[model samples]
Target chain A: MEAETFTLILDLMGTFAFALNGGLTAVRAARVDLVGVITLGMITAMGGGILRDMMLNVQPATFQDWRYLAVAAAGAFIAFAFSWVLHRMAIPIEILDAIGLSVFAVAGAIKAMNFGFGPVQSMILGTVTAVGGGTIRDVLILRVPSVLSEGLYAIPAFVGAALTVAALELELNGVAAAILGASVCWLIRVVGVYFKLNAPRPPRVEPGNLQG
Target chain B: MEAETFTLILDLMGTFAFALNGGLTAVRAARVDLVGVITLGMITAMGGGILRDMMLNVQPATFQDWRYLAVAAAGAFIAFAFSWVLHRMAIPIEILDAIGLSVFAVAGAIKAMNFGFGPVQSMILGTVTAVGGGTIRDVLILRVPSVLSEGLYAIPAFVGAALTVAALELELNGVAAAILGASVCWLIRVVGVYFKLNAPRPPRVEPGNLQG
Candidate 1:
């Protein structure tokens, strides 16, 4: 397959996975109706890309392309319709979430590179693209974003973005490199999830010990 | 002053107000360090404009201009240094927040008009620019956004934006018109805060009454 085609496929898959994950989270977290479920799902699926495009000073691909919207809505609807069954399969849902994270990280980095951003900026944008939607969803539901608090989520995305940037720098801008970067990210995230690992926290301070 | 200069002044004032508000909220709500406080403050100050610029397919003015960064940082620093004093001045802080909301709403609509967007789209963008930063701040601190759940926040912004658009459409785009729109929004918001007013909610449903 052409590189563009491959990337598009990955993007769509990520969109579907993120939408499903977001929808499931909304159903579990809030006393929301159908509108809320689908809205959250679409936001989760499209937010990162929109954020990235904004930084790039470009139109959001999500708004420009119909497929993204359709796929995201479909995934959210499926999650809403089968929340009872999906809620019980937490592990599978997590795996799908990891896939979305990895794909977005890789795709975001590549797009940044195409847009002529520096390696560091590209890597950061990639991670933002990967985690932005979930953060928004968590905020809507009044929870601290897992990316900021306790999770190996951002680290894996960062690593994936970094690897993708490095590959591009080394003139390895092939589909193979993209797959390798995403797969590595997926592996780290899955392992972290299985082991229930977390990034280090600040040393414990007594409540109200530090005034603003 | 030229309309351009006036808009810039309003934008800066709004940025400062939002930064202070965000920093104060962080100090009161979370046990975060200096970095956290400043980060949240900057995000709250700039998120709305960045979101608006993204929709308009333009570079964010916050990143382009050094003044915005300096003003926002200064406001956040002030809040951090004077948290104890500022915390006691609740009404003042709320008034400043309303000022920020009003300024952002009017300026955002005017910019959209300058960019040749339709009145409806401009109105929506203006409201988004007013509320986007606060919404992002609420999410970061893990609270339900006041815009979605309670408060007459979005309504006042929408009204201000509508008025701004109407003025522009009527070829009355002057400093007076801008002030009129923003003042109305600020007045409405301040009154709402004083009265503890809220938008109407959906009818109560039994717990778990509606499936996703």
Candidate 2:
């Protein structure tokens, strides 16, 4: 498969995953009606890409292309319709979310490079594309963004973006490169979730134990 | 003053307003450290313009220029240093926020028009530029976005953007047109706050009134 086609397929799948993730979160956390559910889902799926494109000085594909919107809407509606089943399958949702994260990170980085950004910028944008939507969704639902508090979130994304950049520099076949980058990201994320890994936290200070 | 200069001034003021508004909200609502306060402030100040630029398919001015960042940072630091006094002065903050909203609405619309978008697109982007940052800020603090639930948010922005488009069509002086558009929005928002106005809510449903 061509690299462009591969990236599109992975991106669409990632978008679907995030849409479901956002929709389910809204259903579980808020008293919003159907409009809210679909709206949150679309935002979750597309927000990161939109942010990435804006930084890259290009029109967001979400606004320009109808396919992205249609796919995201489908994901939201499906989640809403199957809320009962989804509610009972928390682990599956988490794994799907991880897949979305990895795909977006690699695709976002590739897109940034295509737009002529440097590797550092590509890596940053890749991470942003992976995590940006969830951050926005969390904020809309009035929660501290998990990106700021959660374990091993951005690390996998950065690594995946780096790998993609390296593959491109080496002129590897596009499909294989994308797959390798995404797989590395997916593995790290799955391990993090399964192991309940946490990034380092600030040291705890005991009350009334200030050192002189 | 040239229209360009006027627009720049208004945009800067709007940036400052949002930064202060965001920082003050953080101080009032969250137990975040200083870094949190500053980060929230910058996001609030810049989020709207970034959203607007993304929709317009242009580089976000916030990312391209340092002035916006410097102003937003100053606003955040000032808010942090005087949060105690600000907490006691809620009305002032609200007024400043209204100013920010009006200015950004007009500026964003004008920018869209400059970028060759249609009037409707300009109006939408304008409103997004006005309210987008605050929406992000509200979400970050774990609160329902006031724009969706509260007093006359999108309305004033729409009207302001429409007015700016109308002025441009009529070949009005740019500075005068901008001032007029922003003033109208500011007035409507101020009145809404003072009168405790709200958009229409869904009809109340009685709990436990299940019909067979």
Candidate 3:
């Protein structure tokens, strides 16, 4: 397949996975209706890309392509319809979430490079693309965003984005490079989840001296 | 002043107000450091406009102009330094927030109309522009967005946006029209706050039947 075609496929897959994950999370976390479920799902699936495109001053791919919306809605609907069953399969959903994060990170980095962003900016944008939707979802559900507090979420995405940027710099920009970057991200995230690891927290502060 | 110049001033004033409000909220709500305080403040000031520009497929004005960043940072720094005093002056800060909301709503509507959106789309976008930043800030601070739950937040914005759209439709598209729209929104919000009013809530649902 052409690189564009491959990227599109990966994007769609990530969209579906994120939508499903977001919908399931809403079901577990909040007392929302179908509209809320679908809205949250679509936001989770498409919010990151929209944010990325906005920063890049380009039209959002989610708006330009109907397939992205369709897939996201379908995934959300499936989760809503089968929440009872899906809620029990937490491990699988988490793995799918990891997949979404990895693909989005790689795709975001590549797109940033295509838009002439430097390596550091590309890497940061890539991580933002990967975590933005989940952060929004967490916020809507009235929770602290996992990226700010959880272990390995943004770290894996950042690492993946950096690896993708390295591949492009080394003139190894292809399906193989994408896979390599994404696989490393996925591996790190899965391990982090399995180990229940945590990123470091700030040292304790005095009660009334919270000033930075 | 020319309408464009008037609008620019209103936009900057709104940015400053939101940054200060965001910074104050961070100090009160989260045990964050200086970086967190400033990040949240900037996000609250600029996130809405960036989202609006993204949806409109235009370059974000925040990125195009240096003044926006400078003003936002200054406001955040002020809030950080004066949190002890400002936290006690809640009513004044709230009034500033209302000003930000009103101006943003009117400006967003005007900008959307200039971009050739229809009345309904313009109105919605305008409300989004007003509430979007606050929602993002609330999410980062791990609270339900006031727009989703509080009285008269989004409603006032929606009303202002609608009035702005109406003024545009009547070819009253200038500083006067902007002021008229913003004033009505500000009045309603202030009244709502004074009365401790609430928008209608969903009817009570049975426990365990929260499916939408």
Candidate 4:
């Protein structure tokens, strides 16, 4: 594969993993076969990028290209078909999630720059794009988004993407810059998960529990 | 009260009713408690508007004014407190829904215009803002959004908002023009519900009930 194509494959893999993550969450939520699973997968995979593009007055990059949809659909279909067996694999999914977070965050920042937004806005949008899909998934499933409630979920993506952009502005190659940023995001997520490094939860008063 | 404040009260009623509808949905889905309920209410009331404003490069109108948050919060509290009685009421949720649709669609369009978006984009954003919260809610919960799947849910808002903007541009007083547009939207919704109007459904194969 050409260099762009090689990078694109990693990007698609990340999308696939995110989509599968969304599908798994939907299954747990018992909203079986509602278009929610498919939508969730799509959102988790494409949501952040879509939000960034739309906000910057650009048509969604996914719409301009087709591979993103194919990857999301393929991932959800695979998960739906073999969920019984795949549910048992924990380590693979973990790795997939980390990769997805890093790639999506980097992609978000790059897209933002292409649309001419300032660096601060680009970083924020990139972080949002990276986690927005998962956040939407959790909220719809009536769970607090892990990004909002969990530790350091979106922050590392911001840091890495911002640093990568700064390096590129200092004349780094685009591919090298993206890989560098993606690595930074991935390392942070892996450490946060394995080491229990996460954000502090807000104090919440429990309401009187109603028996469902 | 000043005319604007009077209209604002009416606007608050619309927000209250809209948030109540969202809270009730969460309840019916068997999810409860204050945090989730409040979040749901806020999402339903402001999701669409936030998306619209962000796209238009303006801060969301709701976050700018505290009244919007207060109305949605109070609405959620009321819904939580009296859900049983409200659920048992003879009238359908559609009645509250119609009132909400009218107020939100009008308010969203007006806000967009105030931010100086062009006629086309303002109408588009207004329609999205009115339904955007619910869309995000459905996507998160993994259900097919009513706007995308249920047919005609958002079109009325689009039409009404477009008309409202056009009339305003034609030198109609803002209040009179908005009222006219809202009534048109309200009537469309009422008629659609009464007549069971529906949009096109996506093509799909049913699971395993096929005749051999």
Candidate 5:
């Protein structure tokens, strides 16, 4: 497959993953009606991309492209309908969430680079794109965002973004580059979760009560 | 002053108001370091404008302009330095917040109209611009955003945006029109606070509360 097509597919997959994650979170957060559930789901799916576009001084791709909206809506609807089942499938949800984070980080970085941003800026934007929606989701549900408080979350995204940027710099902007970037991110995230690894915390400060 | 200058002044004032509001909220929310406070303040001040620009498919004005950043940063710094006094000055902070909401709503609507969006779209963008940052701030602090939960918040913004759009439609896009739109929004918001007026809630549902 063409590199662009591959990246696009990954982006769509990530969007679907985030939509499910967001919908499930909404179900857990409140006794919100259908509007609330769908709203939260859409926000979770598209919020990061919107923010990334704003930072890059471009129109949000999700708004311009119908596919993104359709996939996100479908994913959200499915999650909402299967809330009972999803509520009991925490491990699977976590795995999907990690995949979403990995692919989004790489895709966001590549997009930033395509927009002529430098590597550092691209990496930052990539990480933001990966985690921004979940941050927004956590906030809406009245919890401190895991990015700031939790273990090994932002780090994996940063690593993925950096790898993508490095690959582009090495003239490796192909499927191999994308796979390498995403694999590093996903593997680290999964291992981190399995081992309960944490990023360094502040000296002697009590950890936040929220789980990662 | 030229109408453009008048609108610019109001936009800057709104940025300052949101910065203070966001900074103060951060101070109250957690034992965040200085970076956290300033980051939250800037997001609160600029998030609306960024969202507006995205809807209009243009670069955010805040990113292109330095004055907005400076004003927002100053407001945040002041709030951080004087958290004790600001914490006790809740009434004043609220008034400033109302001013911010009104001006942002009007400015956003006008800008969207200038960019050639239809009236309905302009009004929605305007209201989003007014409340978007505060919504982000609330989420960051892990609270349900005031726009979604509180009384008369989104209403004032919508009213201001509608007035601004109406003014443009009536060919009254001048200082008088700007003043009219902003004043109406500010007055209603201040009055809403005084009377404790709430926007219509979903019937009979207990408000989900997390301590402010």
Candidate 6:
């Protein structure tokens, strides 16, 4: 029970952070007004969980817990109220993106596993959790999804989730499993960025490039 | 075979018209430019079928019929080129909206029934089909869904589809059925607009109501 409460707090914090990042992105990209900023922020934080819950035929996690709304609203409020100062700050956007990625991966995998998903399904859930919100945000804002177009995005979460589910089957407790899971995901992601571990690309097949 | 070809042509025309409508809405909203118009147009035309297929665990209908893409692209092109003239024309938007609604409703119901869904499922499909494209477009544009919030949108389609399916059961043929289905939907929609039939508003919980 205590662990669940702690996890929920972490989840809410992650949501707030994600919302802040979304608001900042919206302002930078499309110059959204305050209402638009809040809407985008809320969507970026809660969109994936909503998708997961709807697909799984469960009540949406955000709707079930008022804390989710509070987190998102608070984040949006802060971002809207302090746009000038925050915009001038040297805060790295990538850090917020990383935090969003890690928290969502953990939350999504846990939710899926709780619903009795197998390791493969759990991994997919984790990937969805990590990237789904941003995907929705981009589509709504009429931008190509960053996940599909750039970066080594989904693979790390997939690997981390598979490891977490695997460790659980081997009888590890929750905290240790989370630390291990997050470590695997975070290490690979951080290293991949620094070292530029390129995702494989299928070269474009132009008509002139076709061989007989 | 000839009848199938005819239906196919009409379907493409209907798709083109709706795609244009979607593009015009975005342009009116002025959130994006050429790219935005095309993207929204494609989504509006194909979004319903995409949602249905995703829910049914099938590959999307647009993937099966590349003509959908052709029609969408053409519609977007026409809208982009002629938007200024169209916007200036004295023609009412309601006529085009009603036509789009009816066509989408019939298409959705037919597709669902053909896919072996029962009546209730078909009804659900009909409702989604008629308004799903518009709903998604509005969401992307960050406007309240016109269907869900200010109009007698979904209900008219629902009624029209029920009549069409019932007619089908009674051995009504293609031309007669299509006419009846479309007319029924359009008449209801026009009536709704003229007389303002809509769902009751949520209570006045919004702030600043007292200021007025």
> What lDDT is reached at residue B178 by model 6?
66
Model 4 agreement with the true structure over B76-172: per-residue lDDT tens digits: 8777888888787525677777777777788888887887666765676677777888887666555656664454567778788888999989999
Number of backbone-clashing residue pairs for each candidate, in the order shown? 0, 2, 2, 9, 2, 0
Worst 10 residues of 3 chain A by lDDT: A198-207
**Against the true structure, what is each candidate's TM-score?**
0.62, 0.61, 0.61, 0.57, 0.61, 0.54
iRMS of every model, one decimal? 5.2, 5.5, 5.1, 8.0, 5.7, 11.1
Categorize the docking of model 4: incorrect
For candidate 1, lDDT tens digit of each residue in A1-212? 87788778878989999999999999999998999999999999998988888798888889999999999999999988999998899998899889999999998998988887778768878988998898888878777766765657888998999998898899984677688889999999999999998764323334688774
Please tell me which model should have the higher lDDT, number 1 or number 2. 1
**Runs of candidate 5 exceeding 4 Å displacement:** A1-110, A116-124, A136-142, A150-212, B1-6, B29-39, B66-82, B140-142, B199-212
Share of native C-alpha contacts between chains A and B (below 8 angstroms) recovered by candidate 1: 0.28
DockQ of each: 0.18, 0.18, 0.18, 0.06, 0.14, 0.04
Residues A149-175 of candidate 5 have per-residue lDDT tens digits of: 556777888898999789889998456
Clashing pairs in 1: none
| Candidate 2 Cα errors over 4 Å, as ranges | A1-6, A30-40, A54-59, A73-85, A116-121, A139-142, A194-212, B1-51, B54-110, B113-124, B136-144, B148-212
Clashing pairs in 6: none
Worst 10 residues of 1 chain B by lDDT: B30-39
TM-score of 6: 0.54
Candidate 6 C-alpha lDDT tens digits along B7-88: 6776786678778888888888866888999988888877876765654446777779889999988887777778888787
Query: Tens digit of lDDT per residue, candidate 4, span A119-172?
Result: 788888888888888886676666767787767788888887887778677889
Worst 10 residues of 6 chain B by lDDT: B198-207
Question: Taking the tens digit of each residue's C-alpha lDDT, what string does model 3 give over B95-199?
Answer: 988999999999899899999999999999999999999888887988778889978899999999998889879988477778988999999999999899999
* Model 3 alpha-carbon drift over 4 Å, by segment: A1-51, A54-110, A116-124, A136-142, A150-212, B1-3, B30-39, B54-60, B69-85, B139-142, B200-212
